[model samples]
Target: MAKRKPAFVLGAILLSLSFVVSACGGTGNGNSPASPGASATASATASASPSQAAEETAIPSASAAAEGTRSYETDKGVVEIPAKPQRIVTDYYGGELLAVGANVIGVEPTAFDNPFLKDLLANTQDVGYPTNVEKVLELQPDLIVVMYDDSYEALSKIAPTVHIPYGTATNIYETVELFGDLVGAPDKAEAFIAEFEKRAAEGRERLKGVVDENATFGIYELTDKGELWTFGDNAGRGGQALYNALKLKMPEKNSNDNQTLQLSMELLPEYAADYMFLTVYDPEKKGEALENLQASAVWSNLDAVKNNHLFMNDFDTFYRYDPIAITEQIDLFVDMIVERTEANKK
Candidate 1:
């Protein structure tokens, strides 16, 4: 009797098979719409062999289609996508895609540095900062998930494309749920959200007890040009985790601003809070920026600086709006607030 492969081995084999088909340009004919700009010259190799042509022309196998795909309405339009896509190419939000267990095959270079995603994406392809359509075609993605509309037309030529609005103040939980739905992991998405909410609530409670009830928090980043930029909930930038989920108070002046503000160093006191979270745009300029800021009596007098409550955060880790990163940020926030509050008491 022949022995059956273990589940993990079989899964790996299936994944390899999917990659092969995608790399060779299997478009899942029935499941995907006609390529908007697919050229005959580009697809000639995909149809070279009769067997390959038949495979490309035939509809997705009913079983595979039923088990692995569904139609989704996106900003671009309604489109069919694999239920559990084996080869995914994402422009931004690779963190959210990874959080939902999607098999990401490609992402922008920026995502390559993300601490949580870096190791996982070691073998993933760099699809270019603006996305190289030719490279994307070579990867043969089952789905192309993008945050920008600019790359949609080019990517749609290679495979099914879906657009999720990025740079909006969309709640992280809602975005996670949407990603879950897109990747066919709605249950997992909901579970993660529930866990996040529970943890956030716990963190908020902990902070309330350790810190002054009226104490406020602010997050800022120093640009390469030595400018200060304050973040808001418009995009996460740790704001959602701190101000929204953890219920950390923000200064009244900043409470209503939904977008990031570029403030001069002299105006630091106006937006200063009891505790400050800082990040740098360019690490090369960090030392100089810190030196310049510290040299200023104005910056020295701010409560956060005077109280020694300024915390420096990594740019890739803290600036992300994805659920995985947000959850991690929340954990860091709780620890910092608790430790600082305790130290201040001493």
Candidate 2:
């Protein structure tokens, strides 16, 4: 008998899992749910200042609005949503809703493998993909929380739908807080947000002595087509935890807004950092690409590669933008950085 590798064990559990297009809408667009056009006036709101938005919409006690439906302003305009929705259908943020203990009766199957949502959603019905308006209607949900623009109208006909602009938020905490208000769990949301902040602060303090303040980090993904992709802000691929929560510095080109940037192999050096995390969607294709890059003089000369600071990240753990996933990402990132920094000292 041999000691089992932890990565192998984790990979075995996640090997059968399929990657969904991140609700935060990262690059490569392959796994994203299709959004057929529908005539709904509600659209995803543009990325607003989270602090300002939070100030405007204070989290009220769950009982404060318990009597009846209330008019809530959403990206789709002011629509009345149940003050305490019993049956909720969420296309993208099902895991986040379940984290706050919302009564989610239906969800997209893509979220089925989410470790955080595994037990909670075991009995929930699959409402097909986000584009399956007919399946969603059959569920007779009291509220529909959507992330895409085109699915709004069709679902709204079945129930009031709120559109949360995917990949637009600046921080995960703000998004969680907003979702809390939508699902009538403001207090729980706030409590989670506070806990996230406290943990992030503690991690930052703990890493100050381990990680160099000036050390820069870079995140990239290789698609099945062999293209390179980078993310920013609320976009997927752990941007919120690595750059925002942990306060790690990133290269200038990678520090832009909440959008994914595509890069060519020739331009790899421009975005290379003191540390790099590479994600691969298709093992065979991305593995070939990784091998080719390893042979390149340009890649060989990069600071991170030469210093052995490159890490391979899994899609399931690192690609999520929700609160529960973000918390996990923060811890993982801190541990990696601390371990690497300490190893370098020896």
Candidate 3:
């Protein structure tokens, strides 16, 4: 992926994640799901499409007839989708639409900086973040793709929105397929999933036996409160990807905070894990940010720190569930961690 400018543009992507944890994480993986069986639960609107595409420009929104056909099950509920849905609006989950050959009429603009979505961003309108219903409705989207949360109320006012809470997919490909079926773009979705799987398989082969598979890893974020907060299995960023996809280990004592924790600056050392993927709060404040975290004695004494196995990941890639960016980041992460760990043993 090409590097993004202003550097902080990437920060915007990472900052967008705070909303993901809050708006998306309600039904923990263990809970019984809410009923998607309600017909009133879905509403479909209409939007623009490419002339060259196989599907028509203005198909029905998912809300029109909830009884027709459902592509797949989702965290929010069953994603009853229209076959060949047109005029899709998405937030957070851009890659899903792209895979299914669905032309995006609009998506939350901030997700564009992901580099993977640059082309899509150029073609579609930016309706602000997921909950910015005013701008989204202006596009007249047939379906608004969103993570299920407090934002659902506002999105419902705009269109027949599909709410897929995060954590439905274990990896990038699974994520793509889950969303693709929801929008009736399964063929395109499967193609994208195939490409991602190929890349991941290649990466796994390259890194195999290079690092200890049993070694634990940690996913963390920098809060506006100026503290480094550690994330658990089902919470933020790499949470689901790490636990479900990579199958790596984690520290024994982990908390279940759907909300981002504010680990005070003094407790930086508490974040130590076998491998630490650091997400800085603000890239502009890097000098001071690194200094503050480094001042803690616990930070310096960690095994990963002493061996220099820590990775400073882009906020957008590490802190949120953007499938395209996450796949790229995972490959980069596997390569670095494996190389570093093997070098340490030597």
Candidate 4:
């Protein structure tokens, strides 16, 4: 059995899912049973800053208010979202909301969702993965968000929808800023980034003291078809951030061949790298692809494999690229790899 590509490969699958537009109103006056936490009297006090006001134009079609944040008046309805939204509904990128001090109204069901969103989930509705417009409408979200292209249309119909377009090659920072401005939470966004940068700096400080900076890491997916799919700078995947943001090294053996290569199972041995990042095709289904890779002779024999340096990560969280999430993610990655690599040397 071959190894599957990185978790970002699911981007292709989600892209194939159907998307639709929705019908809605400007203000949701009548409360549904599942509506988000009511807008408190303090809701009117939520305002934006001067810098936030100046940059409001960049947010997608959203208009700035006197308070500094932006609002959207779409054909479906009007959304007076905060300059930085406090209540956020998401498909897979709900982690971004946490970074910005916002409350998570919903998230895609997954392990990452559980730890970060456990308390919020009790009251939050499951609009379903990629977002269910019907549930979104009932939830009366301040902002409806999705990470894939699949849920765009239906989400837009339900409310003021924002697409994160998560994948391997996507720039996480740019995606983060876009969301930041849209929700009128640029300050919170900036704060999260600062914290992330601090962690990244600490990682870099540690790395610079000892090992060679030019050392490379290889990311690949082993497939049943005997293929070795290597991810590159432009490849949309969660691991791509480690390269793009942290400036991590990539193995020389992993060439510029960013395309998913169909290798014979015999060649899986040749594709093994110094450090491997593992991902499965459809984790929602059978774990066969992953299991096969673990059991393969070629996989067991690799230097990285022998040393136990391969890193396993969550697909849904990693694949969705957002600035806040990206920083948080790479920090974790750097620490994990650095700790593992050092431990192996000992």
RMSD to the true structure for each prediction, in A, is 16.2, 11.0, 9.4, 11.1
Question: In terms of lDDT, which candidate is stronger, 1 or 3?
Answer: 1
lDDT over C-alpha atoms for residue 64 of model 1: 43
Query: Mind giving the per-residue lDDT tens digits that candidate 1 earns over 41-81?
Result: 32342322212222232222334445756789876778888
Put down candidate 2 lDDT per residue, 190-270, tens digits, no spaces. Answer: 555555565678779878877677888888766655567766544556776776678888887664542466677677788
Worst 10 residues of 4 by lDDT: 19-28
Error of 4 at 271 (Å): 5.0
Pairs clashing in candidate 2?
Answer: 42-76
lDDT of each: 0.62, 0.62, 0.53, 0.49
Please provide, for model 4 over 1-346, each residue's C-alpha lDDT reduced to its tens digit, 9 standing for 90 to 100.
3234433344433432110000000000111121122124213222332122222322333233334446655433555555544456777655445444455676665514433234434655566664566776777666676655576676666656765444411233433344455565565445444444455566677667544575566666544433346555434334434655566776664443332434555765666656677654463556677777678887788877776878776544444343433444566677777788688778
* True-vs-predicted CA distance for residue 154, candidate 2, Å: 4.4
Order the candidates by TM-score, highest first: 2, 1, 3, 4
Model 2 C-alpha lDDT versus the unseen true structure: 0.62
Which model, 2 or 4, shows the larger TM-score? 2
TM-scores for all candidates: the values are 0.75, 0.76, 0.66, 0.63
- Output the TM-score of candidate 4: 0.63
